[model samples]
Target: MGSQSEVMHCYEQIAPLTERMLVLARAKQWGELPRLEGQCSSMVERLKDIEPLSTLDEAQSARKYVLLGRISANSSEIVGMIMPQLSKLVGVMKSLDRQRSLHKAYGQPDDAYLP
Candidate 1:
C-alpha cells in the first residue's frame, strides 16, 4: 500500500471526475462520458495498487468515507441516466444485425429491401 497521503490523493482525484461524469450524464453529453470514466478508472486502478499497505489516520478515514460516498452517488446517478440510452442503442444494433442477416440470406442489397 502507499502512504496515507497517496491513498487520499487518489480519492481526491476520483471525486471530481465522478462529479463531472454525473454532470455530463445529466446534460445528455454521452460522448464525453467514456473519456471521463476512463480517467476515473485509471485513478481507481492506482488506488488499488497502493491501498493494500496503507493505513489512514482518523481524519483521513473520515474524508475517504465521504469521498467514496459522493463517488458512489455520482456513479449511481450517471448509470441511471445512461441506462435508457444504452438500451436504445442496443436495440438499434440488434435491429441492424437482423437486417444484415436477412440481407445475407436473401442475397439482396439493403436498399433493394427498403420500404
Candidate 2:
C-alpha cells in the first residue's frame, strides 16, 4: 500500500509483453519468442532487487483485498490472465490420472503409459 502506484506501474510495463510471449508460445513460434523473453527477463531483473511482497499485515491486506475485489469484479481479464496455465495444468493432471487409472485397471504402470 505504501506505493500502490509503483506496483501497478511495474505490472503495466511487463504484463502486455508477457502476455504476448504466452501467445507466441501457444502458437509454437519458438524462433520469434526471444525478443519477448528478453523484455520479460529485463523487467524481472529490474524487479529482483525490490523487497519481497509483504505478508497480510492489516493495511496491506486491506489493499490486497481491494485489488482482488477489483479483479474478481471484472471476470474477463482475471480469467484471461489465469486460464491458460490452469488449463494446461488440468490437462497434464488429467492425463496423469488417466494413466494411473489405467494402471489400476490393468496392473502395470509401464504398460498403462506405453504405446
Candidate 3:
C-alpha cells in the first residue's frame, strides 16, 4: 500500500508460504500446520495495515490476482483435508464425555475408566 511495489512485494512473500502450507497439508504433516498458519496470518495482518497510496499497474495487478487465487485455492484444499480429521476428533471427544457421564451416574471412582 505504500507503493505498488511494496504491496506487490507483500503478496510475493505470502504466496510461497501458502504454497508451503499446501505442500505440508498434502503430506499430512499436521503438526507443522499451526506454525506455518501463524506466519501466514501475520503476513495477512501486515497487509491489512497497509494504506493504499497508489494503484497497481496492469502486470502487478495480474500478479496480485494470481497470487490471491493460489492462496485461496491452497487454503480451501487444506480445510478439505483437515475436516475429516476434525470430525473424527470430535467423535472421540464426544465418546469420552459419554463414558465419563456413565461412570459418574454409576458412582464409579475417578480411575474406574482406564483407557
Candidate 4:
C-alpha cells in the first residue's frame, strides 16, 4: 500500500467523486450533480497545480494510472447517460421551431399550434 503522498491523495479524493457522479448520473439525480461537479472541478484544478505523478515511485504511478482510468471510465459513462436526454431535448426544440415556422408561414389560428 502506498503512503499518503500528495499525488495519491489527489487521486483518492477524485476517484470517489467520479464514482459518485456516475451513480448520480445513473439515477438521473441532476440536482445533486452541479454541486458534486464543482467539488470535482476544484480537486482537478488542485491536481493540475501540483507536480505531475511522474515523480512518484512505481507503485504510486501505477495507482495514479488506475485512478485516472477509473475517472475516465466514469466520465464516459456519465456522458452516455446524458447524451440521450440531450438529444431528446434537441429534438423537442427543433419540433418547436418547425411549429413556429409553420405558424408564421400560414394564416392558421394561433390555437391550432400544439403547446
Best by TM-score: 1
lDDT of each: 0.90, 0.59, 0.85, 0.83
Per-residue lDDT of 18 in model 1: 94
Q: Measured by TM-score, how close is model 4 to the native structure?
A: 0.72
The clash count for each model shown is: 1, 0, 0, 0
Clashes of 3: 0
Tens-digit lDDT track for model 2 on 70-89?
Answer: 43444344346457867998
Each model's RMSD to truth, in Å? 2.6, 8.9, 2.2, 4.3
Cα lDDT tens digits, model 1, 1-115, are 3477999999999999999888888889889988989999998998888888798989999999999999999999988989999999999999988998999898988787667
lDDT-based ranking:
1, 3, 4, 2
TM-score of each: 0.91, 0.39, 0.85, 0.72
- Model 3: per-residue Cα lDDT over 15-76, one tens digit each: 88888988998999999999988988888877776625558889988989999999899899
Q: Which prediction has more favorable TM-score, 1 or 3?
A: 1
Q: What is the lDDT of candidate 2?
A: 0.59
Q: Which candidate is the best by lDDT?
A: 1
